[model samples]
Target: MALGGNPIFNGKNFRGATQAPPVPQAYGQNQYGQNSYGQGGYGQTPVMDAPGWAAQQNMTQDQLQQMYNRPAAGPAETGRMTYDDVIVRTAACLGAVMAGAAVTLFVSMPLASMLMIVGALGGFVLALVNTFKKQPSPALILAYAGLEGLFLGGLTRILDGMFPGVGLQAVIGTLSVFAVTLLLFRSGKVRATPKAMRFFMIAMIGYAVFALVNMVMVWTGAVQSPFGLSTSIQIFGIPLGVFIGILAIGLAAFSLIMDFTSIEAGVRAGAPERFSWTAAFGLTVTLVWLYVEIIRLLSILRGEE
Candidate 1:
């Protein structure tokens, strides 16, 4: 599949995902005898008398030299997305998430539980909105991050209580996985090839089905174990969650690779600077998925121990 196969990148529409960056047009003549700058036509001499052109004609040697010495416009100045833009926006989103999480972390259990529910539902709705919206919205993206933080914080509190220190361990594990995946991508050791994407889609579908069924069973009180089938079902004395958790973490790691690939393509395609928020939002979504998977896996392992 192409780098833009992900729904999160549907707005970009990069042509071939390898098109060269657009070159700025010169002010000189063109095939039609028109000033390529759009100021005048071949039959018009008004462009020569234009104040801006006249000023250029009268420039001092030193002034011309200074103009030549000036640095070229960067991606931001050209109104195109850049890696720096994506980095800054992603940081902002993560900061909002941390702030939201802190709010739930210090609150009473009852209030935190309420906020967790609110956050889960709110985040889900906002995520869908952001994913399908043609244009990226910074405010909504940050709001989604904050809501996810609340859900994560509440979940961590509950899990940490049951498995002391598991929260910190999970955080470390998530960061480690992210760092390793990034390094692999940067080294060109991994990619989202068509074959890999096909496998990823299949696995994702199966995982989603399992998750949905597990959720329903939990709600209907169909399983006595805390994690429903994950704990109740075992293979050779190992809980089913262990295998499922590993698969989930692997999928989340691959998702980070997809995010990286898409963001790189977006930058290369010279997408609108505003789309940096979209890149940031995509990364935040993947990172959240990764963290949740890591934390859940840790909880399951702790439960087993």
Candidate 2:
């Protein structure tokens, strides 16, 4: 007896609680010249050989059709992240940043400064939010872009006010570095290997610590200059800040490489389509960092002169 009833009640098996029909086989041809077999005339037609369990089941046309039409069930689909997606998202972020900048330039400078501060704080918070979210949200990512835009705009205006044309120079510098890094990455000349990644992590930690210390010094009036000790110290008659800025820029560029690598891995691992937001967020972060570093370096150079 099967769990539910007798297994052989209807000439079927009651191996357990459920009963299963006997396997079918190709029967003799009918008047239509089609082979007929079991209750549904299933398995009457020869099918390609199936695996052991499937072969023993002798499936019906309806069953097979149902299986074919069913939604695929498995881990999320992933593939190599395409250049097109990255390019499109990056362009969108840049557009937002430019728009934010334009507002700061045309509007009150004080308001722009406030916005920049707000953006800096807001963007930092949201960056962490999006990074840890199990699933990426497009809205959050775009919001982050907007916030960072405000920050960049304010920063640019401040720097440009101090050093005429510095904004344009920084923009050009950022674009040049991005283009060069992208070309190198595409050409496989530079890669984010494990060793490089380890170094990046260590350098990033050190940089973050230094930035915090510098900011504290500025707030406490320990360093009277606009950029704290960065503007005061000199090496080879050049401001130490300039050298540090260059190194910082290099780190930002390498961070872009890591973002690219992660995107590639996500795509190849069949990550969900929505995860594209993560890629966009990462790129935005790197670009913002790059732009800030370039602008600061320009400011430091101008201050020296």
Candidate number achieving the greatest TM-score relative to the actual structure: 1
lDDT of 2 by residue, 1-305 (tens): 11211110112111121111222222322333233232244456444342244443677778655544544322321222355665677687767777776777777988999999998999889888876676567778788888888899999888888889999999999989988988887888888876776777778788888889889999999999889878777788888788789889999898777666666655554444444556777788888899999999988988878
Model 2 lDDT-worst window of ten: 1-10
> For model 1, what is the C-alpha lDDT against the true structure?
0.83
Error of 1 at 154 (Å): 0.4
TM-score of each: 0.88, 0.73
Each candidate: RMSD: 4.6, 14.9
Backbone clashes for every candidate come to 1, 6
Q: Rate the local accuracy (lDDT) of all candidates.
A: 0.83, 0.70
Give Cα distance to truth, residue 109, candidate 2, Å: 1.4
Model 1 over residues 1-305: C-alpha lDDT tens digits?
A: 25435667776554333333444523333332223333565586556665467666676888766655555555665567899999999999999989988998789999998998998999999999999888789999999999999998988888889999988998899889999999999999999888888899999999999999999999999997879899899999999999999999999999888888888888877777787898899999988889988888888888888
